[model samples]
Target chain A: MDISAFVLFWAAIFTSNILLTNFLGMCSYLSVSREVESSFGLGVAVVFVLTITAALNWLVYHYILVYFGIVYLQFIVFIIVIAAFVQLLELIIERYTPALYYTLGIFLPLITVNCAIFGVSLFLVIRNYNFLQSIAFGAGSGIGWLLAILMLAAIRRKLKEKMVPLGLQGVGISLIITGIMALAFVGFSGIVQIQ
Target chain B: MFTIIIKDVTVLSAIGSLLAIIMVIAQRRLSNYGDCKIDINGKRELVIKGGNSLLSSLSDKQIFLPSACGGRGSCAACKCKVISGGGPILPTEKPLLTKAELAAGDIRLACQVKVKSDIKIEIPAGIFNIRRFNATVTEIIDYTYDTKGITFKFADGEKIDFLAGQYVQLETKPYGKVKQGVIRAYSISSKPEINSSLQLIIRYVPEGICTTWVHQHLKLGDTVSLTGPYGDFFLRDTDADIIYVAGGSGKAPIKSMLEHLAVIGCKRKMTYFFGARTTKDLYLTDEMHAFEKVFPSFEYVPVLSHSEQGDGWTGKTGFVMPYFKDAIRDPKNTEAYLCGSPGMINAVTKALIEEGIPKDKIYYDSFG
Candidate 1:
């Protein structure tokens, strides 16, 4: 609770990265990260949805759930909030910015079920971070997810040229690369510890 | 504990209501695309509500466009010339449209093209002639063990005027094991002269949703819905000798053509080659033979690829192509119309070409 927003942000990006460290959103992370262009588009959409939903869920958790002594309902309430937020955002974005909406494609609505999105809000609550700290963690985790997927997309594009084993092709090679990247991310534990 | 449960419900419902209110408000204010006008072929204009896809909007206005995937953009059958106001071509539409189509800047998948503003589009003039009809199942004759000639009479005594060899989409209501309604295209076997009634010869396909429903669940006097007169597989105007090759249910369109020829008393030299696996697999032999009697120049040759033992004498034994190859002496002087499976069409086309027929003179409609 005494951690500064700056430290929390960096820690979330490095040591406590949502995708690489916790493997929270592996489905879209693996599927959409095959293309750099689509991964970037999906990353930006996730970042936007995550940051906004985190701030909103934090307010709901504290001002309403805690005040009403129904703190145990946070999980269900958080999911509902996230789903509604994503749907509403999709409608608004589709109406206003048609280009951006199409670029996100099916992935925009898919963010509602993405575990990393729900994970961010839950982490903010479990850590009992203040409002500013929660926002920083949310934004940082989103950036962390974006960075990991972009790196994977670049690697996968390059892997297309390499003579991969027939049995170790496609998602098989991708999972191995992700594991190696996860190991590299584990090295950041020495720089900063969130706990 | 009861009080805690009540509090939880109250708080969650309150939050849910608030979000619902926000969503309703945003949807209303954001999705109101206002009145949009569509100019069709620079001749007809339609003023309608905005925000629906061009395909559904046109279909809603009784302007039917052929779509096989039902607007999922998978089939790519609903491409139309969009003169303006279609916005940018989407990535989903990019793979389906050709480079020429994209370069023309006019073609777009009508199902994917959103009617965001006033737009102009061009459609085939033939699409305007298509109409939906409700008909009652008057009769169902088993053509073979697996094939049936089901006849439907127009409910309101309405007549559908179509070319001889065109097809229609038959719609089957969800029944028994079929969970949802299905629409499947079948060539119209009935003659254009039979205005108030239409017949289709459908071969039962294993696990086919519509076919299974038609074969097993459909009953006489049951009302069926069908939409009409699609396809461009008909006899061309020519004085040349006609060569007809058909197998299985592919005989439908050819039958329609022959019926038209019989009705008009066509004098052109015509050779009809029909193929089957055995005696039971063949249908309409007597009917086709009757046509040959009516028109002396018309010849019916039934070929069996696998003639069984104890089967009575057959006219020709082998695939239709081999028999057709040997019988037709001057392929150059003939116009060939083929309808059947893709394999049969390809084999017969190759055979015809080998027999000195021009490839361009061979017209075919190959089904999967």
Candidate 2:
């Protein structure tokens, strides 16, 4: 019996949410999720970069790493693929859609180091996902990260006006909220098995 | 082990070569730019390759415009009016342009606008004169605990002709732990008569990118790049009694103008009021006093805001502006030259205006 693409996709998004459950990309999530508007912008940017890089990394891994039998070099290969893809994407975006590029600004460079992108690629390869399954899982993981950040950003904006305790004013309170959200997401773990 | 290593290297090199070849082919076949021409202010025309942005295109032809961010489009400093041959205005340019700017023909960020076709752009006349200079650090002298006076001698150019208070941009190359070169603006501290070299009075701003490079990384003998003579702060040509007020590193341009007056033998009556928090902040008292002797009508007034215990300060007390208000016999006829932090400039300007000096007669260069 084989796990279907749809099952893996939903499982990766909810039960094994990369941000809340595993906490893979907490740095940018916390820093950029301060404002709802900026968070939405960053979220969309992450989704776009993650989906494209995942597919590109898959191609590189299968064609280059596997062909050379240097599977140990997967990490380096994935990083280089992600960086080059981001640079090419930046040039294309500047030429075709200048507006989106401006809004991304310095954040575009930040996307290259984003952990969620590498996480998605690594998981797809480890799970031996077929091309269709990899695409579905990659896009689903990005959507999951997007949804989690949007919720966190809205909560953070509301908490700005409210009295926050001295010790938990910034990242401390955000981490606590993330822990609670992870437990809530655990409710969906029984619905599907990812690995 | 050597065999495995050789195989790994061979594979990597093969992949690199393949990518390079593909890139070259794509660049040549896919990215070919056709003939393009650019018209400047309905006065001149330039013909060049068509694909690159207007900023780099203009720069290639030696038409320099002020772009502090190096055509990254992040600064929005390189804006030009594209009256014709400009395609749709880009979204990147919208944030920098006002509604009035957009309505008046076509205004575009030069870095963002591609030269897909021949274009006409309206550029300021002053931008035509902006030039890059190769200079060497001739001298570096400490003025205060945190301030240093740096002088750069032009390698080839005999003189840099500039207004008394205008600033020049210094390009600091990446050294030691730094990564990339960056451009930072500083007011020219040297008198205009000595045109072969440029001097700047820099105050250390802790952890500031450009200042840190200048203070820690720059050496006395190394060469550096500079472009300049920007800004509109200068002494107005008038016979009225002059009031010059400055603080901290803001002393640069004011010192230049005062030295300029002595060099030109101008006999206008001038009172220079220098404000400092303490005695340690005061510098060049003897030099200023010498200027007063040279020009019999000039006076140097150093005001201390917070006097020390054993400093034995015997000068005007309190802020510099209030002292000017009490001492000036006729405020209405005085032309003021001010350079300082934005807060100090605002306070002094407000006080001078209240004292019957016309706003037009008062010129200021503020570092915000």
- Candidate topping TM-score: 1
Query: Between which residue pairs do clashes occur in model 1?
Result: none
Name the lDDT value of residue B22 in candidate 1.
88
Give one digit per residue, the lDDT tens place, for model 1 in B199-310: 9999999999888998998989999988878777888888888899889998999899989888887888888998888998899999998888777688888889899878
Q: Which candidate has the top score in DockQ?
A: 1
Q: lDDT value for candidate 2?
A: 0.82
Model 1 agreement with the true structure over A117-172: per-residue lDDT tens digits: 99999999988999999898999999999999999999999998899999988788
TM-score for all models, in order of appearance: 0.89, 0.73
Task: Kindly list the per-residue Cα lDDT of model 2 for residues B1-368, writing each as its tens digit.
Answer: 99989988787667656655655565565455588999999898999898788988998887877676777767666788888877777656777788998887487889888887789889988877777889999899988888889999999775688878888888888877778888777899889889899899998899777888888877798799888777768877878889999988888998899888777778778889988899999998899889978996888999888988889898888888777765566777889989989999999999999998889888988775
Model 1 Cα shift for residue B288 (angstroms) = 2.4
Each predicted complex: what DockQ?
Answer: 0.61, 0.28
Weakest ten-residue segment in model 1 chain B by summed lDDT: B321-330
* Model 2 CA lDDT for position A164: 93
